[model samples]
Target: MSELSMGDALKLFLQKSRLKGSMQAMQITDIWAELMGKTIARYTDKIQILNRTLFIATSVAPLKNELLFQKEKIIQRVNEALGENLITEIVIR
Candidate 1:
């Protein structure tokens, strides 16, 4: 078998572990501002991932409506940023 680099090994482990979703959620949170924008990220109150679904919580009504319309784009941007098709759905609240 070929040797795996440290980064590759860790990635393999994360992929097989139950912490994958949590880890991905953290990663998404970390990059949210950069991924979306300061305005959107600032308005976003919470982010969670479960069963490949992304949940975004924002108290701003206008922002929530805007997010609802951008669900598809958000999924694409998030998955692309993560370098994987990890998010399959999004819930805006």
Candidate 2:
């Protein structure tokens, strides 16, 4: 039998683990939800995550400003949780 090169070994591991895509997606959503829950718990009902985008709806228009102010913190927290930059943008409405 031939030896497996490092690249091939990584590919085989990904295929065997069956977690190359969906797992990352799930983790992204989970991280988004958790971060919102922790940092913006009051707005949980208004938060939505879609394909690398985050949407937050607030009943009070002022809260939009609050969300804007915390944009960097939110992104940093989510990235820390996910171990990568998953959320590309955030919208407050």
Candidate 3:
């Protein structure tokens, strides 16, 4: 077997672990502002990932409606940021 670097080993472990979703959620949260802009990120209440679905929570009605229209763009941006097609669906709440 070939040797794996520490970073690669950790990535492998994460890919096979139950914490992957949580980790991905954290990554998204960390980049939320940069990925979606400060205004949107500020209004976003929560972010969660499960079963390849992204859940975005917000109390702002207008923002929610706006998000609904940008679902496809959001998915594309997020997937690009993550360097993988990790999110296949989005739920705006």
Candidate 4:
């Protein structure tokens, strides 16, 4: 009924496809690295997404504590980076 521009069309396609969730999940790591910086990245053992939650495994206790304090901020930053609200909660271990 209506024509969509290439950029808008592709965005709609991605949204409608069922691949959007997977794509968003993959983008989390890269976005974390860019936003959190290398210092945090260096200590991060693993990052995972499960049921809209982010699970982080870290080697440093202090870093883990610090990240916990910034959990809400990190969620906001990650969503801002993806331009969508994908992460609901962050679990640091």
* Predicted structure 2: lDDT: 0.68
Q: Model 1, residue 62: displacement in angstroms?
A: 0.8
**Model 2 agreement with the true structure over 27-71: per-residue lDDT tens digits:** 655665566665455554455556677666776667678889998
Off by over 4 Å in 2: 1-39
lDDT against true structure, model 3: 0.95
Q: Model 1: which residue pairs collide? A: none
lDDT of 4 by residue, 1-93 (tens): 999999999889999988877777778876777889999988998888777898999989999999999999999988899898888999998
- What TM-score, over all chains together, does every model reach? 0.95, 0.55, 0.95, 0.83
Local accuracy of candidate 1 as per-residue lDDT tens digits, 1-93: 999999999999999999888899999999999999999999999999999999999999999998899999999999999899989999988
Candidate 2 colliding pairs: none
Q: Which predicted model would earn the best lDDT?
A: 3
Off by over 4 Å in 4: none
TM-score of 2: 0.55
lDDT tens digits by residue: candidate 3, 1-93: 999999999999999999888888999999999999999999999999999999999999999999999999999999999989999999998
